[model samples]
Target: MADIDAIVDDLDAERADLEQVVAGLDATLWRAPTPAQGLTIADQIAHLNWTDELVMRAIRNPEAFADEFEGVLAPAHAVESISAGSAIVNAGTVERSKVPQSQLLTMWRRSAAELSGILRALPSGTRIPWFAPRPLSAAAMAASRVMETWAHGQDVFDALALTRPPTGRLVHVVRLGVRSRDFAYQLRGLEPPQEEFRVELRAPDGGTWNWGPADAPGKVEGSALHFALIATQRLHRDDSDLVARGEGPEEWLRIAQAYAGPVGRGRERQRPLDAV
Candidate 1:
């Protein structure tokens, strides 16, 4: 794993970039449409901010999470109620579920700050608890933060007609994403791929990230941010700057996921960035 300091720096930089974008946005754009299905830009930010808090809750007190974990995990979208939404996403639902611009902005602002502080203050050597049937190290937990911030940032940029310059630490998130390919495949109840696949990415500071068994036969390479975006399904293969070369490259790219959990049949790709 990369040094914790480097990871924190990457996380902080992305957080700062996102804040700058939201700070200048008018109220109308707070809930503006994005490429993410029916979700507004506000919903994207709320998902990141809320999920980060939920992840932290598990890390802070693993045992407590077990008490109500199953019920909350039942639905990934369109929760039965705001109360259920809050319970599952570790957020207070009524406040976050509002449609008004002010409420959405407040939700994004406050949650972003709290999420940043949680990841930033965690001791370098700590191992955070993951959702289920998985062991998580401090590095893994931090990587999830990187992945979420980058993935959701894609939403804001897609909505704002903005572009995100690739960052070096993205290599870390990309690597995690590559390594999770089999898990993504399995999420659909398919047999895991047998042959190893190479995934190469550039780090935020211009380092390279590679993952897969040493002897893997093929490779995927490009800007780390693009690779991360593609894997998270935030950017489609054609829209992203990343490239995949191999027999199943396109298919693999289509299904990749990095976060820890039981991956559901993934959400379908949204329309072109401009269509929204």
Candidate 2:
């Protein structure tokens, strides 16, 4: 069984890591453009803050969340295409960007802390409504938060030309990446491969994280950080060191998506710093 407390703790840690990076930024740096086109560092935090607030609503009042979600999916606001969905999601971020940097930071910090507390108190087997096709257990929700924080934080780090050291907390993202393999295909209107793909990643702690059967014909192997990057759409497959041993795994790498949403316009391939 997934340990809810542990997941929540990791979520807290993930938020703290990003908060530390942004907490000291001045107004100019706060408005710095991230790799995500047209979104500033402030906008990224605003997006996280808004989503955290939404998750709290989902947990505290399912009916209200459902009502709001229905409005989001209403005919006038239906997400008919990738750009349409992105416009809906970015609308709040754009408005929130007008807030002063200090106030936005305070808002995100408060919401993140409150979210951790709420997730910690969730009853066992309780499921939370989300934008996805199905509800998620509290633990799954918390882990997804960690993935978002980390993925968005990467854009912040890159904007500042900094490298974030890999950590064991990445295991949450790796697991999510593996679990969402089929969803990645499904979101694109393609059938998932029937055969399971073996995935082996070298974790930051010098340990091998393995999933799938030993004799699986499709296999992906490489650094956990790279896999997580590709899965989150933070890095393109060609920009990573991952190796796919079969057509199934190879194609999966091209379109891997760990988060729920419209297919992401993933980062463009760029030469590694060392190679440049």
Candidate 3:
């Protein structure tokens, strides 16, 4: 498990970065289409707000979360299937969009703060239920929340053509990305490679961060930003400068997912950074 304090700090930093991105947008920019299909900048924020609330609710009251989750899934009965669950969850996002942008921003900020507080106070070994069949530890859940914020923040930044530079805060996301290799394989119903895999990333501050065993047969090396983007499914392997070695590392790099969700059809190879 990671240091919960460090993870919470990074979460705060990521949320602050996202807030900065949306700070000055007018109504038109708020309504502008983001990279996500048919989702606007406002919709992105709404989705975040809704998800933040959902996670908080899950942590505070499992029974309430179950009811709310089932209500969100009322349109579909197969919540066990990833796609069905995703659609149901998306319905909540769409429902959230009915709120005015100003109100949504306020709700997002409040929920984020409440989320941070809950995560900060949780016992290290606590397991919280989420979209995945298995619950996650406090540290893992916090890290996933940060990854979601960063991934969705990219959509907002890309929609506005704003350039968000990589920072040391990305270490949390990179770590989650590396650790999720097996989960990614499981999500796709493929056998996880039986070999150890190594990941080496160049942090924005010129420090090198490494994960997995040093002498592993599989390896991935690249800019931390690129790894994070690929892990979030915002960039394809071909679009990144990452060097992959061994079949395990290469395939893992191609379909990495740091966030818990159904397997996604990742971006096409050679997709431009701006297009992400």
Candidate 4:
């Protein structure tokens, strides 16, 4: 059985961390540009707040979400390429940018807390509507939300040259990264490698987390922070301490993406972290 309770707790913890940081920011800090081009810290929070509302809709009204999503994307689809999706996002964020920073932060906190409650209220094994190839269970949906919050929070932290300490919460992210291995390959139109790969990470609290077959020929071993960094595309694989043993695992690390959406143009290599 999925520890749905634990997933919700972790989600709340992730939200709390981000909320605390964002709440402390003044207007200048909120307006600072993140690592993502053309998006400020306010844009990140706006995006997350908007996404939380969408996730809630998916949870409570799947048909409505599907309808609204189609309408929102209809204009972009006419362009005939994936970049259209980016256009949709850019437009939405630009519109959301009108909201004041303090208001956006409040919206984020309330929406995130509401999302956690919705996830917790769902019965065991309830799958929610999502943009991923398949629907997600309540637990999976919560994990996805946590992953997004953490990754985007990293971007905000990087933009401000502030350190967001790693926590065991990232175990959720690394686990998602491992589970999405095949999805990552499929996103690039490549066949997923047939063999399983072991993934082992040293947690922030001196504990080890392992996934996949222990004796698998391929393996990814490293700090959870490194794995999460690459998986989120914030840091290139070479920039991290992750060691991938064997061709399959190496490739996985190189192209790993733990979130859904059209593939992102990852952070460029050799860029200074503070420069972001």
If scored against the real structure, what TM-score would every candidate get?
0.76, 0.93, 0.90, 0.90
Query: Candidates' lDDT values, in order?
Result: 0.66, 0.87, 0.83, 0.82
Q: Which parts of model 4 are misplaced by more than 4 Å? A: 70-90, 271-276
Q: When superposed on Cα atoms, how far off is each prediction in RMSD?
A: 5.3, 2.9, 3.8, 3.8
lDDT of 2: 0.87
Clashing pairs in 2: none
For model 2, residues 1-276, the per-residue Cα lDDT tens digits are 999889888899888889999999988999999998788899899999988887898899998877766654334322243334456567877887788888998999899989999999988899887766567899899999999999999999999999999999999999999999988888787899999999999999999999999999999999999999999999988889899999999999999988877787899979866873
lDDT per residue (tens digit) for residues 52-101 in model 4: 88788788888776676664334333222334444655677778777987
The most accurate candidate by TM-score is: 2
- In candidate 1 the C-alpha lDDT for residue 155 amounts to 78
Greater-lDDT candidate between 1 and 3: 3
Better of 1 and 2 by lDDT: 2
- Stretches off by above 4 angstroms in model 3 are 63-81, 270-276
Candidate 3 per-residue lDDT, tens place, 1-276, comes to 478989889999999999987867898998899877778988888888888887887888877766756543332322244455577678989889889888888999999999999999987577776676466788888888888889989988888888999988888789888888887887777889887788889999998999889999889998999999999988878889899988778888887988767777766677756876
RMSD of model 2, in Å?
A: 2.9
**Model 2 regions lying over 4 Å from their true place:** 71-87, 272-276
